[model samples]
Target: MALVFRPDKKSIEKTLAALKSYGNLVAPDARFNYDAKDGLRKEVCFRDEDFLSLLSSIDDEYVVDSILEMLKGKALVPPDAFYSKDAFDKLVALTKEKWYYPWTSFTKAMRRLFYMLASIKQPRIVVGMGIFYGYTLAWSAGPSCGKDKLYNAERVYGVDINTEAIEGARKNFAILEGSDHVELIAEDGRLVAQRLEGPVVFLHLDADGEKIGKKLYLELLKILYPKLAKGAWVLAHDVTDPGFQKQGVFTEYLNYVRDPKYFSESILFDIDQCGLELSIK
Candidate 1:
């Protein structure tokens, strides 16, 4: 990730030290405008070439267009990549409700991408970390209609640390049509990951992005690595958010996935700061 901060030697040194603690190497890059006080601010690039390449590869023109159409023109055209009618219908229905938390609702473009990928992957088990009102859980569950169902996944498991949020999600699930396939658990994500036994075909990470977030994410990865099925798809939220980027969350995450052992193909959907990684194990 690219970072531009005020040209303070002490601040730069502190930032570099923090980044190195997360297994990142700092490299000097071209300066850019950061604020009015600083005419031109210094820039630094994290040495995560593989992760950056993966982010570039998955950013498609069609995805960008779809995001613009949804947010700008308020158009709801499903991307051509999403061919499942049932999945599309579910996405539309979920968006109509105001059940999700204001901060946690999935954007239309992100939902569309998830529907498309889930339809294609047809994972046997769908796992969601940090469930907030179950909006993403519904999407990961895929279409519930027997005739319209195209995925092989039988159930979706949602884990969240907040008991109140878990209760809210359960209430939302109760009112949702064809939501019988969802299971909500109020527990730490790390424990949930440890208990999960079967192959995970689809995984979504949407938890916090600081110390707790980094710990839970990495711990879950260690547990899930052996359990991931071939063609498993993983989506991580907020990788490009300004707050996360400032906190070095994105850099630490990129370093983890950049290892050759984890994923075969990975991409960062620039829209809504969603990052996706694919594994063929």
Candidate 2:
């Protein structure tokens, strides 16, 4: 497809520079083509715009790449950057109430990362599918900030394979001292496909590999498409390009989702080694 934005003499260089930034996008080698001839070269990356058009288009990939590029060359900050003293106090209070955060790593790293990202976007509801004792991130973000918020909807509502994890998440939520609106549930995220609702934001921490990720990804789209308000995003974890040392499930799903006709955009991130921040249009 022709890029949405055409290049002129004044903008050709700028457009080329933007394409160069996506040099690391992973795909079948044949997906992109490059040639050098007569002291001239051309590189075709993913189907994107003439760099100038990207500045104006709302393509999901465009937004994701822009955000990732903005994040690059920048150091991550502590949770304090996003959480206020009161919010922190509430989180700690809830944790203490329920004997939560027994693990220092969750408090120090996971929760901190969640809050920092949340502070930037501040979605009303951040849902984590198939949560296994990992609600601290959502709790630390505080309640009443969003229209809908839940942790481990499947586990909370009594879904199978999540009983153990749900028990732990419940204890963690208890520590928050009855900030009960976080809406812990125990229903399968797959079931979400038929239950259309309002604009919802989600975080899929559910561990899935190639086939599983693909299944979950499609199921999630079925459930969330009609429900999502314009501009909603999904943050999926564990996606990476580890030099293709082995058959990686996360890598496969990342590739599948980046298809422009399906999921429009993605932002590669190095959170805990590797991850992709996705924005579905």
Candidate 3:
């Protein structure tokens, strides 16, 4: 459950060696310093290109390990450790495959985080607001396919505006060998919300950014808010970035969730630059 990296010299050396072997990259130098109040301060500087190249070549496990090694420090532990090893391993494999989307896609950490949330929530319905090549859809629904069936959902719905993206998502879902639980719909978020029945326990809001994305998300929430179960969880992507925060892109939506009348708790996970807002209703 220890999510913080807090790497020692040995751990850092091991990670660097792994990166070199996996990506043919090398760490130029490392600085280790200490402050009276903060204790050990460790910094490792490497080429950004090299790191990205390494990420491109390696598998999800290696990527996750490297991320943990690099970001070692005092941090909130992820809930993934609570799940069975088999379930976690399945999630890792599911995320390893390539999922193409026109814009930026979800990272290994983000996918893993989704799996953790799904395992914990075990919702009867899993809804993804933006399908986009079905990567998030697969991540949202994959855990439910486990032997123990971590998610007891009868259906998983993926809604997207782009017809081409929906087509691509269908192919992606097919590649995933999705069962009867999967449902891919090309429609507006409001319509998707209208069609949904029963309490939605897990909701993933990963639509595009800016005015369009903001409007779609707001519309969906307006319709679906009453349908959320008491302990339902919502994951809103791209809301944590400082740039978007300054622009007030999704501030209205976030403010609504932050209000005690709607949600019981909300937390921001600052992973990579892709900020995720986790709210419990």
> For residues 152-249, what per-residue lDDT tens digits would candidate 1 score against the true structure?
45778888888888998888777665667788999888888887887887888876534676446656777887787765777776666545565686
The per-candidate count of clashes, in order, stands at 0, 16, 4
What are the Cα lDDT values of the candidates? 0.63, 0.46, 0.68
* Model 1 deviation from the true structure expressed as Cα RMSD, one decimal place: 9.1
Model 2 lDDT, full chain set = 0.46
My TM-score estimates for the predictions, one after another, are 0.67, 0.53, 0.67
**In what order do the candidates fall by lDDT, top score first?**
3, 1, 2
Local error of candidate 1 at residue 173 (angstroms): 1.7
Question: What count of clashes does model 3 give?
Answer: 4
Q: In candidate 3, which residue ranges exceed 4 Å CA deviation? A: 1-81, 85-88, 91-103, 146-148, 209-211
C-alpha lDDT (0 to 100) for residue 137 of candidate 3: 74
Report RMSD (Å) for each prediction in the order shown: 9.1, 14.7, 12.6
Worst 10 residues of 1 by lDDT: 71-80
Candidate 3, pairs of clashing residues = 5-72, 5-73, 6-72, 6-73
RMSD of 3: 12.6
Error of 2 at 19 (Å): 31
